[model samples]
Target: MRKSQIRNPKHRTENCPLSPRLNYFRIFLTFARNSIVRDMTFRANFLIDCLSTITWSLMDLGFYIFVVFRQTSQIGRDTGWGEWEFYTFLATTKLINGLVQAFFMPNCEEVSELVRSGNFDFALLKPIDTQFLVSLRKIDWPALSHIGVGGILLSISLWHITQREIDPAQLTLLTGVAYIFYILCGVAILYSLMISLAATSIWLGRNESLYDFWFYITNFSRYPMEIYSGDVGTPLRWICTFIIPVLIVVNVPARILAQPLAAETPEARFLLFFTPAAAVACLAISRWVFYRALRSYRSASS
Candidate 1:
């Protein structure tokens, strides 16, 4: 009994303590929940924003459907999408897009502003990790709704993906893992991209066009890269895949579920294999850029 107690206590003590990463996550969750409560205090604005988001999602779909219908009437074929496959692709992309904009971009923008204003000093003074704090400092309540909306749309899209070149079981597991990786890599690439931009704010003072430029570059990912045409399209597609890579996050993942060109084709399989690699590579470059930018950080007010 005594030996058992000693061994059990040792095991319990080891198991009871949280890992350093888990502790950090716990801290983040606590901070996020606190932020949410604070934001909730202004309930009117939160609900209004949430309602606006829902309206935006619905309207976006309505507009797409209307355009596709008109085009089909004139040129025939449903939006070049083939079947339900295209509809859910758009739906999932929309949801993911909203979540990224509402949550990730806002925080990054806020960081740039704070850095520009020299308020980043206050942030650095906080006890927690500066990156963690900056990343989760704010929560847009409306963006949470996008999570639910995207999930529902994705669920609906699953049926269509099934009817396509692949069946449910295979596509679901592959796409599921891919989606998780996409979000992580997407966020990493985004952070890498935005950190460099924020670093620029330290010098450029006003890059009003930066965000717009980023968006313009990313817009291509919403549709098939094939639409870009050849030769020149090849390089442009490379840029979208390896340089910016936002296109792969949405377009490639969606395509995976929507259908395969013919996995049997060498071109299709190569592109499929390359998609995640390209995203990871872009993120890695962004990280290096961010580190370089930090070295050049002039601090606010020079």
Candidate 2:
């Protein structure tokens, strides 16, 4: 019996390394480095997407500027922002959106699909934690155009506001803080949302709606959420806030700039609390759902 037990592989250690969380971060960083190289190999794609990025940014600025001119006098009453103010708001939002699209969302799609194809079994069999590999598989560097367009627009907007020399350090402080928290919440919300959807792939046999869902969610963040102001309707605001939750991810930093240079507003301070908390809960719930859904998966055809 002892010899048989020694020969048997059934009791061997499972292949997984550290828990999912740590492994996810590790693979994510390595994947980032590789993606930069991959994207460079396709220079034409990068140039084309870069032009699109700048064009889209210009269009966004044009839309807001047109609105500003239409209501030049009654501006702040609506967005609490004037022409320059609105430009500033959009510049930041654009930058954040660019980063999210370029880096985060693409990878989320890869993971969720892996689960749906019954390919998840191969991932589970790897010697590394599955979640880590799943999250960091694909990256798009062309999205970096949003960052450049954002900088140019922001500088132009700031120049309009100051009408004098502006300091880079001051600009950096706000953009830096906003970008950090914005990406964190973005990653959190996207992963949670994708996981939730992907979990259903096990039962539904396809998450075809995922692309649509991602497009809708990102659209909110593309514009300044403050425009959704006023009574915020009630039902509309409820949908925007609870269902999509893009406001916290995209608008908070712009909120910082929307107020006066030295704002004392309580709502503007550390305002991402709700979004991050929700992301955590959503991701957790999705993880649990994954295991439950996996049990029901019958491989391929629904």
Candidate 3:
């Protein structure tokens, strides 16, 4: 048997009897367990990281409350995103961002380093799909603090909205199902963008600007897309909406929970339907880009 084949015995037909879907799921659970063990090994550091994340989330919420809400009742001029409603949107942002960071950020950030050190060769030789392995091999457990914080914030926000009778949308089982679905869609869109950027490391040789670029692009998603109206902002709205689709990441999901569809304009209604399609397209494009970049890779030995 060849060296590469021997190193990846899982690829051998006799070594793998389970169905592919089940096999991949088992592999993912193993990766997640290993990650948890690694995090627990550094318990102090993990605790500090979690505390810091929670602190930052609180500070951000406070900023919006003291600064932004002091002046206007709604996020934009008549956008219908009042204080608690906007908080719901903010909470959704945290949930989506938290999930992406916890599951994929660490792995994607390591891609360039792996390429620089020639360790990515082993990843390429793995029996499973390279994208799946590389994207999920390491989970940042501390970042899950954001999800916890977001959940608390969401519950609080929804409670306030209900008490004040401010929610434009009725809360129902179907509404919740749609909200969770779009939240996953938002995560998928962001992951695709991150992995696509990471893939460029193979061609760029070093992609040190990955995080900076990612921050800049995603910063737009932190706010309601309705705020990007008028001449100057309209162009940015168009670019981020149709071209990059970051505008829809948090917006559509938040709108599903915070605002009524009947109150939305025709354009807004159209975008709500378009978001799922955009997520699918982004995943396809990112997959193509990753494989294309992989073909350009040259091992250190070469």
Candidate 4:
């Protein structure tokens, strides 16, 4: 047997170049850089991915132009979310979705595979937070094409709104801030939902339905909540608004920018106030679920 040497606890800490948190931040930057470089190396695939996303966005716009504009003047009878107004809402939805897809989707989509392959054990052993590591380890730069499309759509909608409205002064700094704030809120809600679903892979062994589940839940947010208002849509409205809170994610931000909720129903007011709270609650619950799942996880060797 080799002679055992006594190790000084201070040695490692003193020799470290950065604090634990700072080092983790540096690692995250490295991961982002590496992902960008990797995507650049596959130039053809990256360009194709970008083109596909832009094409899909155009198709979605065409559907609204043909179907919605042809049939109805506005989505809701009472609320003033007309063509350009609804377009603003759609644009906001696109921006939020694009950011989530670019940053979180690829990583969350791989969580089940990592767990099934026993690679998650390596994540757990890292010095940083496992959730952060799993969520941001990969970035899909091409998926961010929607953000540009959304900005263009938003600018057009805003121009229409200014031209149509009697007083274009409604687009104040406060309104702009609120829109940006709630866009970030929407992203947090989506991340929470995705992480919660990814965590389920711990017990289920494989969660092949991650994307399916995500799409189903977020699909509810892509449209105006007003469409789901009548008796036929009441149950769905309540469930998506109160229970899941997905409807509030897009609606709150959209309303802030496209149409102010000054004269809206009492229920709408309640949801507007509750959105920020809902974001915090969802994030906390998802973090708890993720850690709980990790605690119960066993390596493949076991």
Best by TM-score: 3
Question: 1-302 in candidate 3: lDDT tens per residue?
Answer: 34446334456645677977788899999999999999999999999999999999999999999998999888777787888889999999999999999999999999999999999988877777788889999999999999999999999987776667434356889878988999999999999999999999999999999999999999999999888988999999999998999999999988878875532779878886889999999999999899888878888754
- Over the stretch 164-270, how does candidate 4's per-residue lDDT look in tens digits? 74645268788888789988988999899999999999989899999999999899999888889678799999899879989988899988788774425686677
- In terms of lDDT, model 3 sits at 0.89
Tell how far residue 287 is off in model 3, in angstroms.
0.3
Worst 10 residues of 2 by lDDT: 1-10
Q: What residue runs in model 3 are displaced by over 4 Å at the alpha carbon?
A: 1-15, 166-169, 261-264
The digit string of per-residue lDDT tens for model 1 on 1-302 reads 23333222233334547765676678777867876897789999888887887787778767666777456532223324544566666765666676666556666677667766778767654544455566666667677777667777777767655655644324647667766665555555555666566556656655656678667765776665555557898788777776666666665556565654433367657766776676567666755554455444555744
Q: What's the number of clashes in each of the models?
A: 0, 1, 0, 0
TM-score for each model: 0.79, 0.73, 0.94, 0.91
Order of all candidates by lDDT, from best down to worst? 3, 4, 2, 1
lDDT of 3 at 61: 94
Give the lDDT of residue 213 in candidate 3: 97
**What are the per-model C-alpha RMSD values against the true structure?**
8.4, 6.1, 2.9, 4.7
